[model samples]
Target: MTTALGLVAGVLTTASWLPQLRRSWRTRSTDDLAWSYLVMLSAGVGLWLTYGVAVADVAVVAANAVTLAALGALIALKGVGRGREEAAR
Candidate 1:
């Protein structure tokens, strides 16, 4: 079952972000993350989500949706922390 395989792969890939998300939340800092990279990644993930929806692929939709949420949280944390970071300098 390719669908099962895809779901497995999706889970793995989606789970990979947990560490980073945990770290970011714990530290409340995204200093090591670049704005450009985040934007690009979000864009790509968004596209994947759109494609998944368009084609009705549950695996892609589920994976990208979760990934996008994580990315959104990361971006928000990064933006909020930026002010403090700059003020510190």
Candidate 2:
């Protein structure tokens, strides 16, 4: 039951990033997303993943892994968008 709860929590929290990712992907712009925000989120999520691994929490590990991937993609998109903007200038 606790594991179930954890999974539910994980899913909810992780899903929060999907909308932003989808929007960013569709628009190919993440100018609204601050670099500091992305860096902090990635760092915090990485730590959660590490903790999950250390504690052998499958739900946490799974959720954080997915989140990290999303964050990585977001960061990449942000960089690409920045480059595009710079090239335009």
Q: TM per model? A: 0.89, 0.91
Taking every candidate in turn, the Cα RMSD to the unseen true structure, in Å, is: 1.4, 1.3
- Summed over model 1, clashes come to 0
| Poorest 10 consecutive residues by lDDT, candidate 1 | 2-11
Write candidate 2's Cα lDDT for 1-89 as tens digits.
98778778888989998998999999997988999999998999999999999999888899999999999999999999999989999
- Clash count, predicted structure 2: 0
Report lDDT per candidate: 0.93, 0.93
Best-fitting candidate, measured by TM-score? 2
Stretches of candidate 2 exceeding 4 Å from the true structure: none
Q: lDDT score of model 2? A: 0.93
Any residue pairs clashing in model 1, and if so which?
A: none
